[model samples]
Target: MMRQKHNFVAGGIAAAALVALMGLAGCSTTAGVETTGKTSWDEQGARILEKNVVFNSSSLKGDLQIVDLRGVQAGDIMRAQATLRSRDKDTLQFQYRFDWYDAGGLEINSGAGSWKPLLLTGRETKTVQGVAPDPRAKEFKLKIREME
Candidate 1:
């Protein structure tokens, strides 16, 4: 009779642990679903074009800043331009790339972009431009990093 009681207690503990694990799993799954839904809605929002400028290197960010960013449609083709200003007192070498995205917020040419070199002198501002491969490019991301 005593052994039977012990067995029942062990079984109850096991069941409670299982329930706790399942609750945690359900919470994580719900969070995942919510994140996915929010991402989908953001991609489908009313913005025709989205643009972002990011500096990946800390030194580059300290020395330079993106002054202007704009995109325009030129006869059914998308064109992008950016102005970079150097705040340092010396010449700096940097590399930049423009990643194009479609209307659906999907990258046009994933892993197919080449980095272009740029030189900036102290207190100098320069404007760089890029033309999209096709008219389907409605969004763009500009990434700048320091070059060795």
Candidate 2:
């Protein structure tokens, strides 16, 4: 009779442990799915672009408009526009760099640093456009650096 009771207690404990393990596994899977859904480049690239570009006034700050983005088999073509303005009567000089990345989250090689210069008048707004060099570019990043 004692052996029978011991066996019953052991079986109950094992069943409870199995249930707890299954619950933990489910929670782990949910966390993994949530983490993987976010794009790797979204936060880092966006912050870099915004930090370097300065807006004199809330009204004059240029808008970063994405006109078109087409995903090709090997690469992608992204069309973007930006408007710049200065609240004070001072001319501003700026430069931009387009960084391309492959599917494996690595930056592809390009000519030099691939930087382009831009100029703006006081309280003047402007737009800019660019094209990708090749097809292996799955993603792109724009960095605007203030000069002078």
Candidate 3:
């Protein structure tokens, strides 16, 4: 009877260890699947410049919000437009620039971009537009910052 009890205890321990290993394996597999899904999503997003607007300055973000962003092909050039609305009750001065990129996700002219001054009145909405310098620009990133 004692030998049978020992065998039963050993079998129970083995079964518990197997269950723990399987749980760990399941968790690792789930993590791998999630990582792959995220990578795929990122790759797909990289292919298209989807309505992405980034504010480089915290003050600018607090003062204004990007209401809309869109792009169009005008002849051979890519034209981009961004609509901004002031969230504060005071006038705000900011500088913005458009950085163009090609289909493979590279900047068209790395350091040649210029910042343009923007004036926003209290509680007002404004639209800014830019045109790509060349026909090779397939994407664009619009950056806004507070003017010092």
Candidate 4:
């Protein structure tokens, strides 16, 4: 009976450990900042472009700011750039990625983007750029997060 009880305890510990690992894995992708840019025509019959920035992590929002977001077309491909300002007085590292989308708001090359590293010094201002994988991209979203 003692041997059976010991085995049960060991199995329970292993099962608990597996559950804890899965929980942490689910939280591996911690959202930090997301910014979207789109192009459209306004009611004045003029062309208009917009940039929307959203911060999902309070720590990141307190440390950084998205100063400028610009998107342009180079012949047929969409190019995007974003200027970031570090508010903290210390250097920090980040990972940024660009997600391309079609005119109809569907993602292009979904789940194919790789995160590029960015380094910023104290109160530094820097710009990061991204190019679409192809010509079908008409919109873009920039995502910034703390480097793991």
Top TM-score hit: 4
Candidate 3 lDDT by residue in tens digits, 40-140: 12544652336644444555567888787777778888888888899999988877788787877778889898988999999999998989999888777
TM-scores of all candidate predictions against the true structure: 0.64, 0.44, 0.65, 0.78
2 versus 4: better lDDT goes to: 4
Give residue 129's error in model 4 in angstroms.
Answer: 0.6
Q: By the lDDT metric, which is better: model 3 or model 4? A: 4
- The window of 10 residues in a row where model 1 has the poorest summed lDDT is 30-39
Model 2 lDDT tens row, 115-141:
577776675666655455665555555
Regions more than 4 Å wrong, model 2: 1-76
Highest lDDT model number: 4
Off by over 4 Å in 3: 1-49
- What is candidate 1's lDDT per residue for 5-104, written digit by digit as tens? 9999999999999999998867642110000000112555742433444444555567887787777778877777888889998998777777777779
* Whole-model lDDT per candidate: 0.69, 0.48, 0.71, 0.92
TM-score winner, 2 or 4: 4
TM-score of 1: 0.64
Say what the RMSD of model 1 is: 15.7
Q: Which order, best to worst by TM-score? A: 4, 3, 1, 2
The CA root-mean-square deviation of candidate 3, after full C-alpha superposition on the true structure, stands at 17.4
lDDT of 1 at 142: 72
Residue-by-residue lDDT tens digits, candidate 4, 1-148: 9999999999999999999999898777666899998876789987567889999999899999999999887999889999999999999999999999998999998999999999999999999999999999888999999886
